[model samples]
Target: MFFVILLAQTVIGQKITGTVYDDTKTPLPGANVYVKGTSKGTTTDFDGKYEIEIDAKHQVLVFSFIGYKTKEVKVKGKTIVNVTLEQDSATLDEVVVVGMAESRMMKREHVVGYSIARIPQNTESYAAIKENDFKDVIKNPLSTFSVDVDKASYSNVRRYINNGGLPPADAVRIEEMINYFNYDYKAPKDDAPFSINTELSACPWNKDNLLLHVGLQGKKIPMDDLPPSNIVFLLDVSGSMNSPNKLPLLKSSLKLLLESLRPKDRVAIVVYAGSSGLVLPSTSCKDKKTIIEALEGLSAGGSTAGGEGLKLAYKIANENFIKKGNNRIVMATDGDFNVGLSSNSEMERLITEEREKGIAISVLGFGMGNYKDDKMEIIADKGNGNYAYIDNLLEARKVLVSEFGGTMYTIAKDVKFQLEFNPVHVSKYRLVGYENRLLNEEDFEDDTKDAGEIGAGHTVTALYEIIPSKNNSDKENRLRYQTSELTSQALESNDLITLKLRYKKPEKNKSLLIEQSVQNKPVAFTETSDNYRFSASVAEFGMLLRDSKYLGTATWKSAYMLAKDAKGSDEEGYRGEMIRLIKSAELLSSNKQE
Candidate 1:
């Protein structure tokens, strides 16, 4: 009997191995493989190879990857099961519409010159973005901008790519894409809330130029040490959110977040559609069953009364306000607000006015075809909060569960950055991917001015493309009347740039300042850290997607190689997924060219 049992155990624990590939015969790295109806799973490596052990009862294996159709095969006692996935035809057939739609099935039109142009045809909108141009250091030595922790752009771009399409040029925000992945940086050892790090190396695209990386690592506070939170779930269950991915996926995502809450935390439920109402009063985490039941009971119908919903949510939060606690509203929706106060400026004004009362509102965007990204971004920015787009259940887990504290609590507000470049060492410079966040020089010191906010455990990164003074030695048209001479500090000192930062405590009204100086030191591209290389790769990818005019020598092939080589210590596999995305984009670009 013992011998027979051992043999059965060995037979049931058979190992299965295979390599996943796409239709083009290219290996699909980061593909997921698992046994049906089982929790056991593994992801393909850089070589598209995966191995998993299965029980006798679960002989069927499933293989899936982004941008490709999922395939399932019954092992039928076979050990090797190599599989090829086809591109999802339904995803590839999705078309890009530039305007909005009053209803899901209705289209609006306008006259453009002699032709008829569609207006609000599909309802998706993205705020237009203009790339930054090279600025003469002699003319403008100082560059200033607000720090942004919102990461909506990267995931939204991922959605477009995985759906077999390129994201609109205006939708690609390079800074957000780079900051999506975390970098290893030491925590602050002093009284400061964050630490600053800098790196300089040869530009990967333009070898003649240099790239300067600036990183800020926010202090990490353990969950036990975090302040008590008072949260209001401001959900939109309008007719627009009736789709399976919107309402059903959202409910599942919020359930995962419940597992992360502590007993000391409290939550309330407020829903809006054609009308706004309170579904649940402020309830303690101890009563989790009630919360779960309320979430599960939500249904989508009626029009979107987003403005009224905001007002009611803020009112409830203020009424149950916890002193010095994290008071926030997590609003989930597809951002389709056509009923009341729907304009971006109006929403911004409303949020700005209410944020002064010590309540923050973060936006969780969902759905795709009729998504209103522009409005959500504005509201989140003006409300002293962050924004994230949840494309799938996994993304929901990432935003609501994995990053609960960072997404819910704010450590610093009104965060701003100013850098003064030394004209002696740098002639021309361009601040990449912050055209919208750029602030005037005078706004840096103004306490009344509103800037960006940084949440706990958040990291903000910015890059600058620089042209050394040696390359600009020949002046085209030196000002004949007035010539600006380099200062003694610029000539004698080896400083490259001086970085200045300002931020306020979440509950404080005044801002605090911190400053640091970076010396002139350039390392070879091969010698830079993984963080530097990975971020550079993302920036290059964004530029390629946008078809930027400043793309000096960047190619899709270079971006893929850089990301694949620099994918170090990716515990969450996000960096590996980026490498795969680069490959997918490269194939799409090549096919388009052909």
Candidate 2:
């Protein structure tokens, strides 16, 4: 009887295990195997085998893997639980950040006809998108210009919430750039150029904002062992970041980032408040438990000390810089660098030095109310990084994970656009957007001129409204030479305008050029292509919102009505969101003029 009891105990103590594989039968390493949320999880070994302790405690086991989605299975009182992950088709929204601004949707086109007024040439400016023709309002507003979707490549997108569970106004937000499409982008199958397809049909609401049909085909990143990444989490625990929307949302955002990291990566935490200090030394990705614990203990307090924080972060990053691995300092804050490096020049100098050492920076702006937009711009620009504002969780997912390549990896830096107008077919022309990014025509050919960067798969779009010289009607709008003074005889006869683009390949100091021309044709604004229609909507929206003081007779209602009429079905639902946002804005302000 004792021997029988011993045998039974031995049998009960036996471990049950199996390997987890994908549909391809490939061993899935690093898969998470957990029994609910008991803080107990065992990762599969290199061979994907698990010898986890099994008692009467667990009836269902959960399996999760990144990119492949997640799953759960009931053991049925048995011992083994094998999981197969399916790709999550319902992806999150993308965050689209270009240069130093939020890419927004626009609704009007500024057609340049010969203006009888002193300004001449129909101008597309803050005057075009203003809300109330108010000088200050027109010059600066919440958002400006249409996102470069049709032109640029997908960079990132935020996670999706059911039925619009977006983050609060003060939280950080990002959108998933590729959720709108399905890309099987494989490295050029045979080194031929890979191309994505995009098309447009008539727009529903606004016939002008035509429906967009895009199918992108691109070369894929060949599967290879990625260089080990060394990441420094430079967090802002400043007093201004104490709001629930700031610190709490920031924590959740970083947690999402932690989830995306692989076991081979290393992360170090450096935090700043009244001053800066290292919270956690660099640790392997496998040490997720300790890292998460440190993250949870973080609290927001004390005045901001950005200078101190940056120095310490650089020190830690330099200590662990990888020869070829990614070394990035992700700074999260509202760009309030007071108490230290308060001046832009000093901060610029420090960041410049760090950039020279190949330590890149990515600035994530959090919180509002006391948000410092100008500071964020300066840091991101000089830090060799870009700036993004997270108004919600969606933005977090976009920035951290979606289209990670484009946002984190640049294709070309210092891209500049220059257009030389011809006096022949076109009497005059007006550039529709990019008031801030404008460069002198001479800079278009100069590689040394500081310009914008473009990421892999990024497409850039710029538009101009032309006035055909044949139409005597526009003769009034052209900025007539006060006395035909400046132009030499040779300069007086050039077609409509020549658009020039200059850019440098990533890691290359030299520049390349591309040019296209437009003849002043009978093409009226209404007669332009779908691309023009969509672009017009963008320009008009900017003008109405800025409340340009130059808006003599135009009003918000008219602009909104035009946009509503031009907006299409918007199967993606972006158009619908626009209607809601605009309507809400109209209602929020006291100046409601029907």
Candidate 3:
């Protein structure tokens, strides 16, 4: 019958594919492409290419990008649709108020007094990082630190490199860069929340030394199995966020997140400007239209009252406290908090107090100029949550859609790592990155100490560079008053280190323990897994950026080569993008030298 044929036509959907370009014919990466009226959509990749399926009922495909005019074309008779989006003239003449004295319509292209373009002063800030130093195994055998799954530093650095500039030294966090990519480790099969994997291999930067890779793979839970979420959105609509990359991009990025939520999940909207106020009360995801409307109604103006916003958000979360559920605040901002309770210490103290009440806060940082990365990182760390930077729609999709469960669900909290090296096998060792996350040795076993949280399906990686016992010269310089002797078991055992991990269940206060013993046996660098090689490459890249004294023989060319070969099975093209970013960094670094 006609109805049966119509159903058959709908089932056999047609595929449409094409590339998106700007007015200059330059490929526009991260452009949005979708069926006009449905959630079936995709973003253009690094090459500005996209492919989406369409049925008879959905024949129109819409292409859109920030600052560009959206275009919709019919795909009924076409197999391909290439789009060239022109800049919106209306947006160029729109008025934005930057301060009390400055309120004027700015053009997309502004003219300077002379032909030379005016370069704006950079106001971005990052926390100072003192790189970890070597520790003698005989003197300090144990290395303790909290696990970090934050990926903000990596994307922030990428934004810098893509803008044709080298990032500030403190902007590069090696561990975050290494962990930005996914690794293939076996998932936990038991009741444990996560599985630990370790690898020993020759150090790529120093052939005479060794590299120890420790990875934790949080158990993956299906979307249906995840606990219902009570999410409060703490959005910043201050005047500083008036740029195209700030408020507008944030609104679009959050809309993409809405598609991933379920009917059982609830969301509330809170905004901070000259003052803080609630835009929408807690509402179920089933009423997505109301949520979307509230988001679209937001406009950037006034000073930032971030502290007041946090207090109100936490208050609402407490009022709607969902016991045995995921209660969290997803704060999106450029981190420029200039109003009341704006100092770093004050915000930290406030967040520290609220975290004890079973409410977590994840941070989604956006924008560039006047950015406050230092504050956002501190907030996320103290709030028992995670942090990520969204530089584009593609990155937003990665964080809010593809990794929805990992971004929203906490499987374990207060995850800590402590490694005790065997002096008989290793003379000295230094933890790579995580300088700020290092903890006192005794703090590892203390249940009251705060640490990091690992979300469902999140992978945390750490690296340590070690020197073999045979290369030690400390014995010759040992103090005459103190003579150390090795144990017979230490000399006979093949273990190089004993790794210990502690973590708590999402709703529990007490911590569970996981212990692993690493063997002294090591393989050649080339024989190691892609996970080891790729992570080493990222560490080397970070060193080059920071100009670290401990870089050894690491070079930009070497990092690029290592990453090129180890970018295995990058289905999402994230690894491939990292490879490109490496190449971009090399060019920028070389130009700086010139």
Candidate 4:
């Protein structure tokens, strides 16, 4: 009898089991079940079933899932403790507001005397954008701007279209839309990090203007040859992220990335809600199971302390920094920072400071309605990193798995492009996009001026619309007091523009310059390569969505046909998807017009 009692006591201390459910009695798969105050935990399986070993000192079991209030039950010497969590009212209200906004059933700003916190959650979030205007080539000959490789806007807009609505104009970033699709540019040949390709063709939208397409292709590095990585996952577990599409999806997305990590790589996890804390210290990729367990145990709650989380994540990344290796922080959030150090400026300053220590920051935006895209974009821009939106598992795979090297490893930094249009060939010109990335003409040659970074196997594209000098109908009159004249050499030259590219090695501060002069070689729009046609289609689509004043004769049907024709060897189906989206948008726009 004494031996039997001792064995039973040992079994009781060794294990505890439970099932977790939401208010509607639906099984909450992926819900976290753990002993309070301890790292020992396990996630509920598909059936909401979980079994975790318990230490004798740990007398309480905690059950948690995003969007549901967390529940803690004292063991009290019980063998089983099933839990049902109530829906968090604040989160439900936010979801309701998002639904109303999507349906256009109500205006969030109609509530009188409402504070920001109390304002209807229906207010969709987007950054303000002012489109670029035409520049007189004689007066403003130099067009300089940083390269932007971020593709968040494309996926975010897709999410809206897929949900049966057109995206807000401010959400449609033309540069990002053009960059999302891969182009068939030539690969780098030598020690240079990337190769540049240029093509000039007649503009499809505006018959009077010509389009100049510039492309950059980064050298590809084999996965086996990639350096060891030191990555810290800065995850937001605040109340705002307590939704099915936020925290839960984020965990699943990170798991896909974990499958790509090698034994030489290391990972750390830092989670923040009302406060910040390190859940897992730096661990080798070989111990993936342990790392995954830590991720599965995380549950969203409380307010967002994003600044605090950023600091802690950067500290962890710095501590485990590897020389000549990929050191970065992958931040997954909805961009809602309501508590401690929540201001955009403060967050930007923190990211900028940390990036100087050689740790890049890649932001993965999730959720909608309350998303702070402006904040996310700025953080990634200043942090020497890239930004992508993960709307679903496929997009997560695209960013975290398929484009691993290009998304995480940097080969070149501070990349800027400057173009000088010759008055002899071009009368007026305007950059198609990159309004926010514009830089001072002098900043192009300044090595200290920060710009965008290029990763392995990455590609950057830019477009310009130019009016020929022969077509002088829109030309401005010469200054009344001063006579503008071109040199004999300029008059004899056939060069339309001189393109100059400046970039620095990932580890060096010195910049390298590459210059190429484009002559008056114009091809018909239909005779252009698939790269030119596809990119032009994307830009035209963006203009139509924004209802830009500059969009002359651009129609959805034309953009759709162009995209379908130029969908070349799209192994990833991204180009095909764009065609379908264009069709959907056309229908939506037509319905609205009716």
Task: Name the top TM-score candidate.
Answer: 1
Task: Summarize candidate 1's per-residue lDDT along 540-569 as a digit string, tens digits.
Answer: 999999999989999989998888788897
Pairs in clash, predicted candidate 1: 100-120, 100-123
Q: Which stretches in model 1 have alpha-carbon errors above 4 Å?
A: 1-72, 77-121, 471-477, 480-483
Highest lDDT: give the candidate number. 3
Per-model tally of clashing residue pairs: 2, 82, 0, 0
Candidate 2 lDDT tens digits, 1-594:
999986665456334576776554645654556554333346565455666554444445666543344566666456665666553422111111111121121111211110122222321111111122211111111112212221111111111111112322212111112122223333324642233332333332233322332222333332143356788999999888877657887888888888768898899999999989999999998999999999999998899898899999999999999876667788888766669878878888888788767677877776544666556655766665666667555556656665454445454566665555444344433443444444554566676566655434444444443333453343333345442222453235443445455566555678876555533332343543433343344444444444434333434465456555555544433443333334333433222342
Q: State TM-scores per candidate.
A: 0.86, 0.59, 0.84, 0.80
lDDT of 3 by residue, 1-594 (tens): 999998999889899999998775756666667676555667788677989999888798877654456677888989988999876533212221211111221231221100222236789999999999999888898999999999999999977765446789999999999888889988987788998999999999999899999999989999999888899999999999998778887999899999999999999999999999999999999999999999999999999999999999999999898888999999999999999888888888889888988889999999987899999999999999899998877889889998887788889999999999988889889999999899999999999999999998999999999988884355344767977777787778989999999999988899999888999999877789999999899999999999999889988889988987887876776776676566657766665676
**TM-score of model 3 vs. true structure:** 0.84
- Order of candidate numbers by TM-score, starting with the best: 1, 3, 4, 2
The predicted structure with the larger TM-score, 1 or 2, is 1
Candidate 2 Cα misplacement greater than 4 A, ranges: 1-229, 263-265, 323-325, 467-495, 519-532, 549-572, 589-594
Q: What are the per-residue Cα lDDT tens digits for candidate 4 across 508-585?
A: 989999998998889877789999999999999999999998898899998988887887877665776677567667
Q: lDDT, candidate 1, residue 523?
A: 83
Q: Tell me the spans in candidate 4 whose CA falls farther than 4 Å from its real position.
A: 1-121, 471-477
lDDT of 3: 0.85
